[model samples]
Target: MTLTNEFFQQLESLFPKAADSPWYVYAALVFQANDRMELISSTWRYVQSTTSKAEDQIVKARKMREALLKASVLVGFPKGINACTTLRKALLADSPEIESELDKDSSLRQHLSRSEKDARGMDFFSKIYAQHTDRVLQNMSVASGGDLSEFAINAVYGDLMAEESRLNAKETGLLEFLACYATGGSVWAQAKGHMYGSHNLGNGKAEIQGAVKICDTIEETLDIKVNRAPAENWSWLAKAEKW
Candidate 1:
């Protein structure tokens, strides 16, 4: 199916625009939209295929393990962590301090119930992000022999920053990132506060509905694999040669 305006808007809602990203950021956005769909689909099957109700909680508790494995395979550790942490930060930015406190304590939590715990598992997904970030820094530092290479460190920094910027432009926080970057100074400060109001998040739900159709298509269509990389050996491959 074609991506609707509503779909792009939903992607933008999650990752606000910033100066650091290239236009191909849209590819990442589409992949993310698809990933969310795959995740919910996987979870549902895990629930439905179980033979007994007693096994439900046991399987559900392992959802993080499942997601983590999927992430390691799909994007390796750093990119996966970067995605999860950025999304978590975006979620917090949307709600902020008192709003988050209220979300935790309010009837919304009651409404979400067990799902809230799964939502919070987004935080645990960041372990790989941190692990890979440290690895990149260490390798590049050693490559430069303890002194930071203006070229090497900046190259590494640029990749990390681009990932951050890509997340800003594609999903939950892009508008805020765009607004703050464009406005600068105190206007930027005010922009952050202005982000709390609601807008249609579009078919994040419908994307879930279409997930099963997309799953088999993924290997051929998207080349996603769930256990493809070991985080320790992961390195940022340059997209092109330096000028």
Candidate 2:
């Protein structure tokens, strides 16, 4: 699907224009997960042209890369791999010099031991899951015979989502939310979990509601339809603090 200037104007209305806000990155991730590769480069280019400063572009670019990496756990590696490659090529074509500003080896994986990584992962998982932590873990263990639970804590949470040097807890949580949302309505339960996770990380209810609207806009713009859950499925978020 072709992403028009008008479409991006709609996105800018929904999110802040700051580099840290990086709504385009989230949009790119959504497009990538949905197999709309044609729109990915244009989305990145639109953000780059509107960003005004060189340093800010670098920051947004890095966050885009980090988001693709972290969200891979939910959206699958093939899409993540293609998205990263596409973004990198787009960055190079636009401003080859900006590549040097990015971190060559930003991940903490090399610096931490396996046990330490697991601890970091569990800590992050606990923070996101909050009151639901134990129950979620128990459910995963029961559902997958302990394998999924163990991998989620040690690998997905520890190895990826817990890395906050680039994207903070809230941003990472939002990526998780977007990744699940992009995959379509069948994964709404997973999307709801990450939406709550984003809220737990300090996103306001209205902010997330705006994100949901943005996702809807993306789907509608592309003329792609999937059986999404009803809006009532998320009404409980109005009382998020209790859960």
Candidate 3:
């Protein structure tokens, strides 16, 4: 079935402003359908014709991508990796040197301007190490204890795994999924738990699957490999969500 109005209604109930512009919903819908390579292809095609017109549309597209990230997070949609990567890819392809162009945009400059977006990354190592006292110390209690567990988890999950500058949790989730899909490691297992806990318990089953499905689409379109490990059984529904 197509993404129904009811689906948006559910999302709107979560974020009243999400319904303000169709871009957010439209991005979600296209990703859900996973048709014709979806967002990346769409953005690529638009960029081609919009070279002269693209200056303005480019700004709009950036806004739409940001909105998509926010909306996905609020609605618990998990396609943020695709959204983040495809949006960036299209933007880069459209303008090989976007750093200056993005800065020139009066509307988008504040958020995306290099100074702002690249202002800083979370020292998540410090944050999680500071936050998850129990988890950290608990592991330390075991033979696998010492600075090793803290360093490893904080380095991978905390440092590398957590956060992209302009992305939110949903986008970050998908980013994590992409990495896990590629590596086929413990992170994939963690992502599966996150899907079950956050998205699946909510009205987000299709969204989670869409995240996985896009991995295939990405491999096809980008000619990369994914789901390198089935031992994690990420393909399994873990007993599906009603949607």
Q: TM-score: which candidate is best?
A: 2
Cα lDDT of model 2 by residue, 1-243, tens digit: 467888987976786445357677678777878877767788878878888999888887888888877877788888889888888888778868777566364555667778977898899999889999999999999999999889998889888889898788887887788777777566877877888888888777555765666777888888878665587765554654443
Order the candidates by lDDT, highest first — what do you get? 2, 3, 1
| C-alpha root-mean-square deviation, each candidate | 19.0, 2.5, 10.2
Give per-residue CA lDDT, model 1, range 1-243, as digits (tens): 343444333443333234322211223322443444333323333333432453433333232222322233223455445544444343344324422432343221234333334333222222223334355446656888755533323322222222221132122222222222222234433222212110121212222212222332333344545332343221211111110
lDDT of each candidate versus the true structure: 0.31, 0.78, 0.44
Evaluated at residue 177, the lDDT of candidate 3 is 38
Q: Order the candidates by TM-score, highest first — what do you get?
A: 2, 3, 1
What TM-score, to 2 decimals, does candidate 1 have? 0.22
Best by lDDT: 2
Model 2 Cα shift for residue 19 (angstroms): 6.0
TM-scores, all candidates, are: 0.22, 0.90, 0.42
TM-score of 3: 0.42
Regions of model 1 farther than 4 Å from truth: 1-39, 69-140, 143-217, 221-243
